[model samples]
Structure formats: structure tokens, C-alpha cells
Target: MKLLSRLVIGLVVLIVLAYAAAVGYMYFNQRALQYDPQGPITTLAETTLSGAENVAIPVDGSVVNGWYQAPAPGKPIIVYYKGNSGSFSAEHERYQQFVADGFGFVAFDYRGFPASPGSISQQGILDDAVAVFDWAAQKGFPLVIWGRSIGSGPSTYVASVRDAKALLLETPFLSAVTVAGERYPYLPVALVMQDQFPVNQWILDVAEPVLIAHGTADTVIEVTNGERLYQLVPNKDELWIVPGGNHGDLWARGIWRQAEPFFERAVATP
Candidate 1:
């Protein structure tokens, strides 16, 4: 009996140590696991769209590089906030569509992306987001801001305080911490994540019309995140949960059909 007890105690000690080591590894490498700036994303050989201009906006001691073109008459400009990875240039064709439809747009690389400089953090990105909106507000076009995936953090933050006419979230999450908890259920991720972008909390404050688009098959952020966020929005416009649509494919599944009309209604002419 004494020998069996000793073996059981030793096994428990080993288990505890292994669990501690796993938690430590995750805590140290959280950012690397979350924000991936080096991965390859879809890109065009070159952007050939007409009338598009390159721009650099200074925000809180950092410069954000991007492309901008003003909309034609009676159209609201689309201020696009992209995902955590890749440059905005990957969406040049979408920009072409925006231009083709007479909608002006500004899409930029967030801080820590290739041309933009600054460390990535929840508050830092939020600060940069508001500054980007302020810069585009100079054009004085009614604004329809949209965010995709991880971009939901800054997009929701901007809508909370800025004068944007509409807010759109694509495959969004309830919050960064909530996502971490989903992916790392074994660990106490909610307590350790450093860059929690409490998007659910921010969504409660958005007054303008808000639209949420999520795929029922989105495995990255999941559809429930969008549905839950939709419930929190004060001026909920529409909840577009596409059937069989996955993350990054909602656009192909006719999201623009929904988004365009939402924009028109949000910024409808009196």
C-alpha cells in the first residue's frame, strides 16, 4: 500500500508540472499564435484600377500606408478594416468593384504590417482606427465602415465613437479573449491573454446602423460570435448568416448584395 501511494503521488506531481509548462508556453507565445504578418495572402500582379491614389496617414506617431479614392456624387465612402494578416493590397479587385459602383474607399495596413509602423496591441489598434476615420472624414463623404475577421475589433471600436453612417462586421468574434478561450479550452486563456479586444462590450455602444455577416461554416471565428454580437448592437440593421459559407467566402456568396443595400439605407439621402 505504501509503494502504491508513492507511485500515485509521483504521477500527480508530473501531471501538474506538465500542465504548468503548457500554460507557460502558451502565455509567452500568444501574440505569435494570434497575429500572423508573414503568411502569404491572395494578391494581384499589380493594381491597375483607374483613379486610385496612394496615401499615407499619420496616426499617433505612426504612418499607415494605403490606397484611397473618393466616391462619386450621392455615394458613401467605404472605410475598410482588414484582418490581422496580409496587406490590404490583396483586395484590389474588391476596390475595383467599389470604384466601379461609384463608392470611394480607403484601405490601409494597420500598425506592424509591412509599410505601417508600431507595435500591435488592442488599444494601439483602436487608437489608429479612430485616427484613420478622422483622416477620411476630411473628404466629408458619408462613411460606411466595414471590418473582416480580426478587423472587427477596430471596426466596432470606431463605430462606438466615430460618426460613421454604417458598421459592417464579417466573420467577427465576440472578443479576442472569447476566441482564445474557444481555441484553448484546456488552458485558462481568459486570464492570460494580453490583447483582449472586448468587442462584445464595444458593440453595446454603437448607435449607427450595424450589419453582421458571418458564414454558418466559419471555423476560425465561428457563426455564433457574429450572432451574439448582433444581439448586442443597439441599432441592429441586419444579421446575414450565409448558409454553407465559410470564412473568407461570404463575399463570393453574395454578401455585397446585402452590404450595398445596407450602405444605401444607412446613408440614404434625405
Candidate 2:
């Protein structure tokens, strides 16, 4: 009987130690897991970003680098917040579409990515987002704020605090903690996660029209996040769940069909 008791106690101790180890790893490596800014360091000389001028905006001891292309007269501009992966140089096709539609665009690389050098945190990115919005606001054109993937955090936060004609979220999550929970159901992710980009809560404060697009087959961030955020938006615009679309294919599926019209109607004077 004593031998069995000792065996049971040993198993329990092992389980406890393993859980603690997992928690420690997640806590320490959370930033690394959440951010991947490494990709081709693109230059204006390399891509077909026609009529785009390089822009630099100073914020919090760092300069965020961006590209700005003026729209044709009497058109709105899209202040684009890129996803958590590559530099905005890779967003050429989208920019081309904007140009074709006579819509201007302002896109930038977040700090610690490519030409912009600094550390990234939730508050840090959010602050940069506001600074960028302020810069774009100077152009005197109607604005549409578009956020994709990790960009949703800053977009929702900015939308709550600033006024824009529209807010667009593509392949977004409820929050950083929520994504961690989904990815690691065994771990106490909410307690351990440090970068909690609470898009769900921030979205509740946005007063402008909001359009959320997510892929039904998006494994990076699930479709359910979009569904829940859609319900939370104060001025819900549209929720697009692309059949079998993944994280990066919404544009290929002709999202521009919905987006162009949405932009036109959003800025239309009533």
C-alpha cells in the first residue's frame, strides 16, 4: 500500500513540474511567438509602387517609414495597417488596385520591422498607429482605416479614439490571449500572455461603420474570432466569411468587389 501511494505522489509531482515549465516557457517567449518581422527588406526602387513617395514620421524616439500616394481629386484614402509578417513593400497588388480605383493609400512598416528600428509591444504599436493616423489625417481626404491580422489590435484601438469613415478588419482575432488559448488549450494562456491585443474590447468603442472579413478555413486565426468581433462592433457594417478562404487569399477571392463599394458608400455625404 505504501509503494502505491509513493507512485501516485511521484506522478503528481511530475505533472506539476511539467505544467510550471510550460507556463514559464510561454511567459518568456511570448513576444517571439507573436511577432515575425523578418522577410524581404524591400526598397522603393525594387517594387512597382508607382507614384508612391517614401514618408517618415517621428514617434516615441523612432521614425516609422511609410509610403504615401495621393489619390485623384475628390477621392478617399486608405490608411492601411499591415499584418504581422512582412514589410508593406509586399502589398503592391493591393496598392495597385487602390490606384486603379483612384483611391490613395498610406502604408508603413511598424517599428522593429525593416527600416523602422525599435522594440514592439502592444502599447508601442498602438501609439505608432495613432501617430500614423495623425499624419494621414493631414491630407484632408476622407479616411478608411484598414487592419489585417495582427494589425487589428491597433486598428480597433485607433478607431475607438479617432474618427474615420470606416474600419476594416481582415483575418483578425479576438485578442492575443484568445489566440494563445486556441493554440495552447492545455496552458493558462490568458495568465501568461503579455501582449494582449484586445481587439474584441476595443472594437466595442468604434462608432464608425466596421467591415470584418475572415476565411472559413483560416487556421492561423480562426473564423470564430471574426464572428464574435462582428457581434461586438458598435456600428456593424458587414461580416464576410469567405468559403474556404485562408488567411491571405481574401483579396484573390475578389474582396475588392465588396471593398470598393464599401469605401464609396462610407465616404458618401448624406
Candidate 3:
């Protein structure tokens, strides 16, 4: 009986040690648990286009930084919410492509990244996106929201709450909690995660046209997450699956070729 009691006690001690390790890990890597921003790229805000103008807009009690390029007088404006890593300056090529395609573009950095001030959080980012959209509307420009990877959270959230011409999501995950759960199945992510960024829940309420692109070779968030999001949207939506294309390279693989047609069609409708 004593031997059996000792074995039970040992098991309890082991479980306690494992739990302590998990807590410690979660504390140290909380930023990773939230949004892990890589080291600031030196080329983050450098503009390559001849006519591109750098601009700043206020968001959530802070000045959000971005670049603006006008392609035409009456073209729809594309407000791009970029990924977590790089600043808006690094996305000039994308803006140039859109400008060449006859669309005006605005790409902005979130708070606490580069020139933007204030702390970063899920709700803060969403509020910043809304402020940007409001700024665009005030300028009398129609808006098309583009979200990539982590940017999908605020973009989709704003799209659901506001009126937008269309939405483009690239390599988006369902939610931060879901992704964390998948990555760390042993952790109770639902309870531990501070910023949930629930895109799956918000997409269901978004009525505007949605274009989702995912690459089969994506290892970070997996293509299944994009598929799941596409399936959840209740309104007009299209999912473009790129064979062997990985995350952050959907456009490089000609996925944008398929996407541009859909974008044109959506813009032409009504």
C-alpha cells in the first residue's frame, strides 16, 4: 500500500512540474503567443516608386504610418493591412503592381512598428484599420481591403463591421487561439491567449465579396485554415488554391493572376 501511494505521489509531482514549465514558457514567449515581430528591417519605409507619397493617419490615439500612391483620379483605393513582420515601406512592390493595374493603394504599419506609436494588440490593430478606412472614405475614395497573414484579423474584423467593395485575404488563419492550439496542443490556448483575433467568428458576419488565396505548400498556418475560413463565409466568396505555393508567395506564383480577374469582376458588379 505504501509503494502504491508513493507512485501516486510521484505522478502528482511530475504533473506539477510540467504545469510549471508550461506557465513559465507562456510567460517568457507571450509576445510570440501574441504577435511576434521580427527585428525591424532597415528598408521598412523606403519608397521605390517615383510618385509614391508617404503619409500618416491617426489611429487609436496614435499616428499610423503608411505610403499612398494615386494611380488614377477615380480608381478604387486598395488599403493593404500587411503581415506581422515587415513595415509598410517593404511592400512598395505590391503597391506598384496595384498602381500599374490602375488601382490606387495605401499600405500602413500598425502601432508600435517603426514610425507608429502606441502598443500593439488585436483590438488596437482593428481600431487602426477602421480609422484608416474612415480616412479613405472621407477622401471620397471607394475601398478594397487587402489582408495578409496576421493582418487578416483586423482586415476581416473591419470588413465585417463596415461597408467595403471587396476583401482579399492571403494565407489567413482561423484565429490566434486556433493556431496556438494547433501549435501547442498541450496548452489550453482558449484560456491563456490574451489576443484571440477571432477571424473565423467574424467572417461569418461579413457580407461583402471575399477572395481568399492559400498555397498548398504553406507550412506556417497551413492551407486548411484558409479553406476553413472560405467555407465559413456566408456571402459571395471565392477561394483560390495555388498548387505548391507557400505562404507570402501567392502573388509570385501567379495566384494574383487568378485573383485580379475576380477583383475586376467584383468591382464591375453593380
Candidate 4:
């Protein structure tokens, strides 16, 4: 009986220590764990959109800012959702490509990322996307939602909920839990993750034309995730697997050359 009692005490102590460590880690690294929407985003928003005007849309009681480059009056407006890091500054060149393609382009930084003020969360990002979409609709512009990396989650969610003309995902993951599992297989991510972006579930509900692109050599979030996501969509969606491309270098490596044609075809249809 004494041996069993000692065993029980040891197990209880171990559990307590584990729980405390998890809590401590979450507390101290909360900012990093969550999104830090500072620095580069501000500089990106301030710069002109090359050929279009810069605009700000209010979201979550704060101004969610962006750049608007008008191509033709009646052309479709491309609303871009960037990756987790950096702001519009880092993404200006990419935005210019869409504008030069004769599409009105609007790309913005999420809250806590530069000019915007607010904490970031999975749902918060979706809400912000919706707000931007509404703003575009009000401006009499047709909307195409484009998401890259982490931004894919909100873009997919918004596309599922709204009348998006088309959906574009670049280097997207299947879900947050799937990504966390890949990075930390030991942790119970399914239960611990507070911001779960289940793109697999949401993609099923999206009725618009969808285009998913991923680099074949992507190391950060593998191409498999994007493939899995593309496979899950009920509609016949387009998937582009770039040869010898890394996560962020898809555009730099000329993936856009193929993408621009795909976008032209997709946007032209309806």
C-alpha cells in the first residue's frame, strides 16, 4: 500500500510540473506565439500602390489599413492576404504584378501588424477579411480573395462565407492542428491550440473558383499540405505545384508567370 501511495504522489507531482511548464511557456512567449503585427507592415502600407491609391478600411473598431491600385474601372479587384510576418512593404512587388495584370489590387496588414491596432487571432483575421471584402463591395469593386501562407486560413474562411469571385491560396496548410503536429508531434495541439484555422473544413463550403499554389521544395510548410487542401475541396479547383520552389520564393522564381495566366483565365470566365 505504501509503494502504491508513493507512485500516485509521484505521478501527481509530474502532472503538476508539466502543466506549470506549459502555462509558463504560454505566458512568457505569448506575443511570439500570437502574431506580432508590427514593423514592416507600417512601411508597406505607407508606400504607394505604384498605379493605384492607398486606402484604409475600419475593422474590429480599429482601422485595418491597405493599398488600393485601380487598374480598370470595371476589372476585378484582387484583395491579397499576406503571410504571418512582415507587412505590405515586403509584399509591394507582388502586389504590383497583379495591378500590372490589369486587376485592381488591394493588400492590407492585419491588426497588430504595423498600422493596425489589435491582437491577432484566427477568427479575428477572418473578421478583418470580411470587413475588407465588404469595403470593396461598397466601393463597387468585384472581389477576389488571395491568401499566402498563414493568410490562407482567413482568405479561405471569408471565401466560404462571402460572394468571392475567386479564391487563391499560396503555400497554405491543411489546418493549424495539422501544422502544429508536423512541427511538434509530441504536443497535444488539437486540444491546446486556441487559434485553429481548419481550412479543410472551410474549403468544402467555398463555391467560387479556387486556385491553390505551393512550391514543390517548400520546407516550412510542405507542398503536401497544399495538395491535401486542394484535394478536399468539392469543386474542381486548380492546383499549381512549382518545381524547385521554396515557400516564399514562388513569385521570385517565376511562379507568378504561370499564376498570372491562371488568374486571367479564372477571372475572365465569370
Each prediction's TM-score against the native? 0.95, 0.97, 0.92, 0.87
Best by lDDT: 2
Judge candidate 3 at residue 237 and give its lDDT. 65
lDDT of 1 at 6: 100
lDDT (CA) per prediction: 0.86, 0.88, 0.81, 0.79
- Supply the TM-score for candidate 3: 0.92
Give candidate 2 misplaced runs (Cα > 4 Å): none
lDDT tens digits by residue: candidate 2, 129-151: 99999999999988998999999
Name the regions of candidate 1 deviating beyond 4 angstroms.
39-45
Best by TM-score: 2
lDDT score for residue 123 of model 3: 72
Clashes of 2: 0
Arranged by TM-score with the best first, the candidates are 2, 1, 3, 4
How does residue 267 of candidate 2 score in lDDT?
Answer: 90
C-alpha lDDT of residue 1 in model 1: 100
User: Model 3 over residues 1-270: C-alpha lDDT tens digits?
Assistant: 999999999999999999989877896777665665544643434545667776789865568877776647656888889888857666677777888888888888888676577778777788888988888777676778889999999899989989888898989999978888888788777886778899999998888899899999998888999998898987756888889989878878876686567667767777
- Tens-digit lDDT track for model 4 on 20-75? 79866755664577564656444543545546665779876778877876657657
Which 10 successive residues of model 3 have the least lDDT summed?
38-47
